[model samples]
Target: MAKDILHMTYENSLTFAQDLDRDDPLRHFRNKFHIPQLNDKDVIYFTGNSLGLQPKNTRVYIEEELEGWATLGVDGHFHSQKRPWFYYHKFSKEALAKIVGAKPSEVVSMNNLTVNLHLMMVSFYRPTSSRFKIMIEAGAFPSDQYAVESQIKFHGYNYEDALIEISPREGEYHLRTEDILSKIEENKDSLALVLFGGVQYYTGQLFDIGSITAAGHWAGAIVGFDLAHAAGNVPLNLHNDQVDFAAWCSYKYLNSGPGGVSGIFVHEKHGDAELPRFAGWWGHNESERFKMKKGFIPMSGADGWQLSNVNILSSAAHLAALEIYDEAGMEALRQKSIRLTGFMEYLLNGFNLGDDVLKIITPTDPAARGCQLSLLVSKNGKAIFEHLTRSGVVADWREPDVIRVAPVPLYNTFEDVYNFCEILKKVIF
Candidate 1:
C-alpha cells in the first residue's frame, strides 16, 4: 500500500485530488472529526500542528465521565462501569504505545508537555561539573528553549555558556545530520544532555532521532526528544531507538482537545532505575499508595514520573482520539501522509514563485519532514497571511514571517491541499 501511494503520479487538478480522496481507505475517517464550517463549507484547516480538529466522539467520551461523576459521585474513582477514573491514565496506554512504537510499560500518559519535559530533565539532566552543557536545535519552539534554559539556571549555570544550540549553516534551512554528529563529537566531554524536537515546529524538519540518540549516547550524554510535533504526525520507534526518554503533547496530531494530557517514554533499561524526580502519591507504588508512607516507592516504568492523578475529563478526550489512531494504524497513516504532503509540495513547486517573494523553508525531501510546510513570505507576509485567514484557511504564522500549513492525513484531504494552494496563488499573483 505504501509503495503504491509513493509511486503514483500526481496532477495539478481538482479531479485528481477528488479521485485520490475517493480511493483513500481513510477517507471515511474525516467524518469522525468536526471540521470547522464556513458558510456551510468545510474550511481548509491546515493548522493541525498547532491544534488538532476535535474528534466527534470527544463529547461522547467526556459526557460518559460527566454522567459517571453525577451518579457515582466520589465512588467513580474506583467504580465507574466503563473506565474506572482511578485508572484512567492506564486506559490510553496500549493505544499510545502503538502510536509511538513502544511497549505499554515504557510509556505513560500524564501531565502537560512542558511539565513532563522538566520532570524528565530532573531525572536525566544530572549535570556534573565536567559534563554540564546541554545541546538543542537552534530556533526550537520558545517553550522548549525556556525549559532548557531554566533547567540550566536551576543547575547554577548560565544558558549562554551551558546551552549549545545547533543552528543550520548560512542559507540552509535545516541541519545536516553530519553537522549535528560533528557538533556532538566536538563537545562530547561537556555535554550532559542532547535534547531536540523530533520534528522542528518552524521548518517542519524531522530530525534523525535514531542517529542523534546513538550519537548522544556515544558521547556519554543522556539523549531525549520533545516530540510535540513528531508524536502522531510521523512514524517513530522510540523503544527500539533506545531513546533514554521522550515527552509529547496530544493536542497536535494526536487530536486530543486543547491542553490535553501529555505522554512520556522511559527506555525499559532505566524504567526501574533510581533517578532524581519530583514524586507524588500518584507515582507511588499502587499496592502501598493507600498506606500513606513517607518513602516514595515509585511505580515502575514511566508511571513512576507521574506527579499527580490523571485529569479524568481531558484524558477521556485523549482516549477518544487514540481510539481512532489504533484503528488506522501509524504505519498506514504515515504512508498516506507521505503521499498527501508530497502532492502538496509538488503543487507548491509548480507556482514557480520567485525566491524574493516566497521561500519554502521546510525540507523538500519526504523523509525529512511530516505533513507541514513552512513558507517564508518575504514580501507582504502578514497581508498574505491575513488573506489566507479571510479565505478561511487555518494556518499558523510564526514571528516576523513564516506561515505554517499542515495537511493532516487523518482528516485533511488532497482536495483541501489543492484548494489551499489555489487560495495562496491568488494572493501572490
Candidate 2:
C-alpha cells in the first residue's frame, strides 16, 4: 500500500509540490539535506520538530576538521581548515545572530540545552527578600521545570514561593497572552523574572514574546526565554524585542545532529550589567586567555558567559547547518512553511474522519504557532502512533496521547503532507 501510494502519479501530489516548488525561492535547498531512504523509498519525514534531517554538507564539514587534526596536530587550533578550531564557533556567529535577530556580540554558540539553562539561571534568578518569584508556563518542557526548581532551592527559597506557573484555563489546549499578562500584574511585587518557552514544545503555541517581555518589565521583573523549540522554527527578533537572555539547542529544528551544542543570547543592554555569573577560563579575555592569568577577567559580550572552550566537533555540525540556513534565508523558508502547514490543516479537515477519532490541539491561528501540529488522538493513541511508524510515516508521540507531525519547509514538500493524510485516513477508517 505504501509503495502504491509513493508510485501513485496523483495530480494533487505532483501538482501541489511542483506548483509550490516552481515559485518557491528556497526550493533548491532540498538538495542540501540527506533525506532518509527506506526500502528504496524516501520516507515521509515529518519529525523536524523532534530531530531535523542532517545536511549533506555536514559530512564534508566534519571531514575537513578530521583532516586538519590528522595533518596540523595541535597547530590545527590556528590553521589547516576553512575555519580554525580555535575560532570555529565564530564561523557561525553572524549567521546565528541573524537567525535569532540578535547582535553578533550578543550571541555565542556553546554547551547543550539544560547546561546553558542552568548557567543562565545562575546569573538571572537572583532571589531577594520581597521579589523572588519566577513565572513560567505550567506545561513547560520537563527539563525547564527541573532547572527552575533546582535554582529556587539553591537560593534557599521554597519552590512554592519562588515559582509561579501560568497555565491554560480549564479544558483549554492553549494559553492566552492576556492571562499571562494578568498573572504578572497580579504578582508584580513578588515577581522576579518571567521565563518561558518562546514556543511550547507540546502544544506548538508561539507565545507572544515581545508582549511578555513588556509585561514582565512593567512589573519590574527580568524576561528570558527557553528557545529550544522556537529558534529555527520561527522568526525570533530577540535583540529588537529586548529579551534579557535566551538559550536554545541546535539539534531539533536547527538540524545540527542529536545532542548538538546549543546557543545563548544576551541583550546588548545587559552586555555590561553588573550581574554576578559563574565564570571560567574560556570566558577570559581572548588576548590574555593563554597567558594563564590569575583572575578571570571575563570578555565583554555573550562570549563572556561561556564557561569552557568551544567543543569543536559539535560546533562543526552547527556551522554546517548554519551555512544551509544562510543559503536559504529564514524569511523565504517561513513563507513556504505557512503554505505547507496550512495545507496539512486543510487535508486533515478534508478527511472528514469523525471528531471522535482525531482532534488538533495546537492553535488554529498561524500567527500563534509554527510548522508543527499537535494532534490529540481520541483513542488508541499509542497503537496508532506505532502503526504510523510501521507504515513509514515518521512522527513523534508525547506521553498518554498526542502525535506531533512537523513538515519542515527546508526539506519537506506538499506531497509528503498529502500522502501522510491519505495514510492516516486509511488507518483510522
Candidate 3:
C-alpha cells in the first residue's frame, strides 16, 4: 500500500518537492501551526514526535479559559460563557476517541504521560506470586522503563526477575513480530502484564497492537500501551483491539504544548465496580461529586480513571488542537502521513553514504513504523545534528548516536523533507 502510493523515483531537487507540496491535500494546515522561525524564515521543523508545533488558535482557546476565569472567578466552574471548567476535559474526549479509534465512553483527559502510566499500573498491573512478570520492549522510552521497574519493586519483587526485556535479534535493528510472539508464548506462564510503547520512542517502530493484545489475552495476561509517540501520529483501534488499557501524552503529536494534559482508555469490560483502582474525587459519580462523598463510587467507563479535576488552561490548548484534528480527520491525515513518512524514507534510503557514514535504524516496512525515522549516523552523529540545527533544521538528538526526524502531516511538507535532506547531504560531506 505504501509502495504503490509513494515508491516512485523521487527526484532529489527543490522543484520536485515543491511540486509535490503544491498538490498536497493537507498543505493548508501548515499555515495553521506556528512554525519556528530562524533568520526571519520558517525553520524546517521536524520534531513533532517530541513537542508538536502549537496551533495558531491555541492562544485564543487559552484566552477564552482565562477570560472565563477572570470574569467569572469561582463561578467559572459552572458559569463560563463558553465551556465551563467543570467539563473542560469533555471538549477533548470526542476528538481523542476519534484519534485513537475508541468509543467516547472509554476515553478521558487528565494528568501527564508517565503519571497516567503509573496510575494505570496501579489498577491493571495485578501480579500474583505465581504469575508476576511484565514484558516490555528493550528500548522503550526511559520513563516507561522506570515506571515498569518501580511498579515491580513496589510489589515486593526484584526488577531483574519480574521484568522481561524483549530486544531485536543479533544483527537486527527492529524486533521481529515472530520473535515477540514466540517470547510471549514461552513466558505466558509467568507473564501477568504486557506493557509496551505503542511506537518505540527510539527506533520509531510501531508495534502490532491488535495482534499483541490478542496474544496477551490468549495467554491469560493483560495488555496495555503507552502511546506517547503514536496517538495522533498513527491510526489506532484501541476499542476494537480489546486492549485492557492505554495512556498517552498530548504534547507530542497532539500539539497541546509542553507538558500538555495526558489521557487514557479503559475498556468498558473493566468499568465494573469490582475492579480495584486508585480513586479520587474527580473519578466519583458526577451526580454525587459535590456531596463530599463518603464511599467512593466511580463514574462508569474511562471517566472512572480520572485523578482530579481537569487543568483548564492545558485542556483549553488541547481543545484548540483537537478542533483542527476534528476538521482534518484521522483517516485523511493518516493517508497523508503514510505518504509523508514514505517520502522521507525514500530520501533516506536514497542517501548514498557509505555504510559507516550513516544508516537508518527504523523499519522500512511502513506498516511497522510511524512518521519518525531514526538515523544512526556513525561516529559524527552529534556533529551532524548540530550542523543540521545551525542549518535551520529542527529535530531531536538522542544520546549515543541517533537523529530523529518526523515530518508531521499537519504542517510539514515534501519541501521540508527535501530541504532537510539537502542540509544532511552537506553535513555528511
Candidate 4:
C-alpha cells in the first residue's frame, strides 16, 4: 500500500502537488469544510491540532435540532421523530465505535474530555497504600496532567509522591517505547494506573498504545489514554489493544465545533464490573430512569458512565462532522495523511534549513506520528510564525519556540501543504 510513497520521487513544484491532488481519492472531502479567508483569499489552514475548521454541514445539523426544539417544545424529548432528545446520546454510538475500534455498547459520546477522564479515573484509579502511584508521560496535555494530579490528591495521596512522570532521556524530544516500558516495570509495585495521551501534543508522537497497554497490564495497572490529538487524526484500535479506558474531545481532528461533545471508550470486559463511578439518573437503567426510585441500577456498557443527558446542539454539530468521518473512513484518511505529511516533510527538508535555523522535532517515522509536524525554530521563531500568519498561512506556535502544523486529511489537500511550504520557505529563507 505504501510502495508508491516509498519509491516515488517528489518535486518542489506546484504541478507536482497538483498532480498528487488530482489523483487523490479523498481530495473532494476538502470541499465539505469551509476554509477560512485571509485578505480575500482562502488561508492555508494547518492548525487542525489546535481546533478543526468548521464543517460546511454544521449549521444544517444544528438547525435541525433548533427546529425540533422550536416545534416540539418539551415534547422533543420523546416526540421529535427524527432524533428524540431523550435518546440523543445514542445517535453517535455506532459511528464513534467504528472510529475508535470499540463495540457500539463499549463507547459513549458524553461530557467533555476532562470530565470523562475524571469520571473514568473515579472508577479505575483506585489506589492502595501498596499500589497507589499513577504513571504518565512527562508533558501530557495540561488538562490531563491537572486531572490526573487532582485525582491523586483526591485519593489522599500527594501528587509529588504518587505521580510518576516518564521523561525522554536528555536531548530527546520524544519518548522511546523501551524507556516507557522500563519505567512501568520499575514502578510496577507502586503503579495504580498508567495514563498517556494517544499522541504527544507537543512533539506530535503517536505512542504505541497496544504495546503500552500490554506493558501496563503486565505491571498490574489499569491503562487509559487521553486521545485529544489522536481520535480522528489517526486510526485507532482501542478495544483490540485492550485499553481500559480512553477519552477525546471532538474539536480537533473530529472536526466538531469548539467544545463539541466528547467520546469515551471502556473495554467491554468492564461493561458489567461492579466498579465505583459517579452516577446520575441518565446512567441508570433506561426503563427505570424516570421511576425516580432510590436505588441506582447502572446501564450496561459505556452508557453507564454518562452523568447527564447529551448536549443536543453541540452533539448535532458532532454528528455532522462524524458523518464525514463515516464516509471518508479512518483507514483511507490515514493513508492520505501519511503521504500528505510526508510530502510536507519532503518539501521542508528541501529547504536545507539547518538545525540552527529550523528543525523538525516530530518523529521521522511515519508510523510514529499523525499529520502534525512540530518544527523547533532555533531563533526568531515567533517572528517567523507571525510572518506566516501575515502571509495567510494559519499555523500554531507553542510557547517559547515550536511551531505545530497539521494538514488534516478530511479537509486539507496536497496543494494546501505545498502552498504552505512555499510560503514558509519564503519567510524563513
Candidate 5:
C-alpha cells in the first residue's frame, strides 16, 4: 500500500518484523478476521486493545442463532440443538475459564461490562463504618469511577472520605507496584475493599494481580479487578492468584461485537447460594429455574451472581468469539502478543525522531504491560494521530496528548508493525 515499499519493510527493519511474522506459528490466525480496508487495501490495524477486528466466522455463528430465533422464537430457549437459549451462558463458560485461568464453575457470561462490575460489587463491597474506604487507581475508566462513587454514596458515605485513589508519582505515567502495596498497608486499618483494572486502560500498565490480591487479603480487604484491557490480551490466573472477583467486556481483545455480553469470575470459595447476591431466574438451579419459586435459590459459583437472563444475541456473539479463543488458546496468543507488542516497541524506540516526536509512556518491561503502548506525544500529537488514521492505521488517541496502539497477536503481523513505523516516521519529519 505504500508508494515507497522499501522504506516500509527495509529502512524500517530491525526486529525484522517480516521474518518474525514468517516464523509465527499463529500467523494463520490472521486470516480468521475481517481486516478493515480503505482504498481496496487493509488498514494497519493496531486497535485490538480498544476494539478487536471482527472474525470472518462471527456472522456465520450469529446467523445460526438468528435462524433459530426466526423459526423457533420461544422454543429456541430449550429446543434448539445448535445452542439452547435457555442455557446460553454455558457455551462461553469453558472458554472464558481458560482465558482467565479459573475453574468453569467460577465464570459466567452475561450482561455488559459495567453491569457485571456493579453486580460483582454488590456482593463484594461490604463496607462497615469502621473499615469503609475503597482503593482504586486515580484515573480509572469513567464507568468504574462512577460505579464506585455511586456504590459509596448508596452506602451513605461521602466520596472524599470513602474512596482511596492511588495516583502515579510526579513525572510518572504508571503507579509503582511497591507504592500500591504500601498504600494497601497504610489503608488496611480502614479499607474495606481494593479494586483496580488488571491493566491500566490509559497507561497500559499491567498491575501485579497476584501481589495485589495477597496484600489486599493481608489488609483484611477483598480484592477485585476490572479486566477490560487485560482479558484475552494477557495470561491471567484469577483462581490461583486468589483474586476475589473480576469482570470483563468482550468487545476489545475478546472480539465479541459492540456491547457484547460480559464475563464474571467469582472464586469458588464464594460459591455459596446464600452469599447475599442480587439474583434472577437464569442464575437459579437448572431444574428449579422454571419452578418460579417464591424466593431466589441461587445457582452455585459465579452464575449465582447473574442478575437476569442471558442477553442471548450478545451472548451468541460472545460464543462466536470465544470459540476462536478456545482454538488459539490464551497461552499461544500471549506468547505472540509479547513479540508483536515488543516489535512495536522496538520500532518506536528506533524511530529516532527525538523525544519531541513522542515518548512511550507504557511500561518498558513487557511483563508489566499488555499489547498496548501509550505514546505521550509532546508536539502536534492530535495532528499526528489524524495523519496515522489517514494513512490507514487504526489506533486510539486519548485526550490531552497520548496515542495508544496495540499490535494484536491474533491478526496483526510484523509487517503491519513495520509499515506503521515507516508511516509514523514520515509523518513526524
Candidate 6:
C-alpha cells in the first residue's frame, strides 16, 4: 500500500527554504550561476555530476579575453586584459589551491582530462620488471582505463601483468576501505603504484585517499588519484594527504564549460625530484623559456608540468568559475550540499518505490561520498531515464543500470529537490 500523498505547497517550500537559506552561508551563491531553461521554464537540473551549468559571469570573462585578442593581438600575451595571457594561469592558482587544499606551488591548470592523465602517467607510471603492477578501482572511467592500458603497453608490459583491479565484493554495491588496504598488503611486493579515482564516477563513493595513500606507501608503492568527480565537490587536502600526484577536469563540479582545461597537483616534495617525464617548451624556466635552450630545465614547481602555452579561452572559463568558488568558499558550499543531498535522499526514500524497483547504490554515509546519488533503476533504467529527460529533468544515465543525480549546492535549492522528488514520484506511479 502506498503511503499518504505528500502534497507540496509554495508556502511550505518557502518556509523550508527560509529556514535553510537562513542557515545557508552559501545561499547568496545562487545568483552567481546561469541556470538552463527548457520550454521557457528553468528545468530542475540535478546532473552536475555530468556537466555543471554555466556561471553567469562566463560570457563576460570570455568577451574580455576576446576583446583583448582583437585589440592587442600578440601583445595580449603580456599586456591586454587586466589578466594578462602571459600570466593568466597564475590568477587561478591561488583559488584552485584552496579548492583542493594544496600550496599555490603545487597546483596548475593545464590540458584536458585524458591529456593530463597521460602526462601524469608519463611521470608516475614507472613499472619495473619485478614490481610492475598498477592498482585501480574496477569500474574506473573508460578514458582512464584506456590511458592506463596504453601506458602499460607503451612501457612494454602486457596489460594483464601491469594492471590490478580492486572490485566490489559479491552482492555489495560499494567497496570497503579495509578490503582495499588488504589488497594492497597482499600485493605489496608486486605493486608499483596505486592509482584510482578520488571519487568513483559511477558509484559516487569517495575513496579514503588518506588511508589509501598510507596503505600504498606501506606496501612500498606510490599513490595518486584522478579527482575528476571529487574535486570541487568534496574537500580534498592533497597537500596534507601527501599523495604523489593527482589530476582533475574542471567541466563538472568546477562549472567550466565543456572540454575546459584541467588541473594537476604535484606535491611540493617532488618540486625538485628528478622524475623522467615527457617535457614541452612551456615547462622550461620562465625567464629562459623563450631563449630556445638546447636542454630542458623545468620550471621549479607544478607549472613545470605544463606541456604547452596556455589555452586562454579555456583558462578564462576556469578563471570565471574559480572566482565563484573563491567567493563562496568550499566549506560553505559543502554545508549546503550536505543538506541538499540529504533532502534528496529523504525524498527518494519517501517515494516508497519498492527496493526491488529501484535502489540507491551510492554509500549512505555522508563522509563516504559527495553530492551525487547513483540510483539503480532495476526495471527499466533506460526507459525511466528517457522519461526523465522528456519531462525536463536533466539527469544522466549510465549503461545497464544507473541514473546519476547530483544536487549541487552552489545553485540548487530545497525547491529543486522537492520538485525533482515530485517528478520522480509521478514517473514511478
Assess each prediction's global lDDT (C-alpha) against the native. 0.93, 0.87, 0.90, 0.92, 0.88, 0.87
TM-score of each: 0.98, 0.95, 0.98, 0.99, 0.96, 0.95
Q: Across residues 1-429, which tens digit of lDDT does each residue of candidate 3 receive?
A: 455564556776789889989988889999899989999999999999999999999999999888888888999999897898898777788899999989998999999988999999999999999999999999788889999999999999999999999999998888888888889999989999999899999999999999999999888999999999999999999999999999999999999999999999998888654677889999989999999959999899889888799889999999999999999998788878878887777777777776687888988877898899999988789999999999899999998999999989999999899888878987786
- For 1-429, candidate 6 gives per-residue lDDT tens digits of 011112222233546755766776777788888778889888888888888889999999999999999999999999984988888778899999999989999999999888888888888888889998999999899878999999899999999978999899999888999999999999999999899999999999999999999999999998989999999999999999999899999999999999989999999998778988889988888899888979999988798888899999989989999999898888777766777777778778777878799889999877788999999999878988899888778998898888999999998888787877777878878
Residue range 227-333, candidate 1, lDDT tens digits: 99999999999999999999999999999999999999999999999888999899999889889879999899998988888899999999999999998998878
Best model per lDDT: 1
For model 3, give the RMSD to the true fold.
1.2
Q: Tell me which residue pairs clash in candidate 3.
A: none
lDDT of 4 by residue, 172-246 (tens): 899999999999999999999999999999999999999999999999999999999999988899999999999
- Measured with C-alpha atoms, the lDDT of residue 257 in candidate 4 is 86
- The local lDDT score (0 to 100) that residue 104 gets in candidate 4 is 93
Cα lDDT of model 5 overall?
0.88
- Candidate 2 minimal-lDDT segment of 10 residues: 1-10
Candidate 5 C-alpha lDDT tens digits along 306-340: 77887777777788888889999887887777777
In Å, residue 390's CA in model 5 sits off its true spot by 0.7
The global Cα lDDT (0 to 1) of model 3 is 0.90
> Which residue pairs of candidate 1 clash?
none
Q: Which ten residues in a row have the lowest lDDT in candidate 4?
A: 1-10
Off by over 4 Å in 6: 1-23
The alpha-carbon RMSD values of the candidates against the true structure, listed in the order shown, are 1.0, 4.7, 1.2, 1.0, 4.4, 4.3
Clashing pairs in 4: none
What's the CA error at residue 233 for candidate 4, in Å?
A: 0.7
Instruction: Please report, as a residue range, the 10-residue window in candidate 5 with the lowest summed lDDT.
Output: 1-10
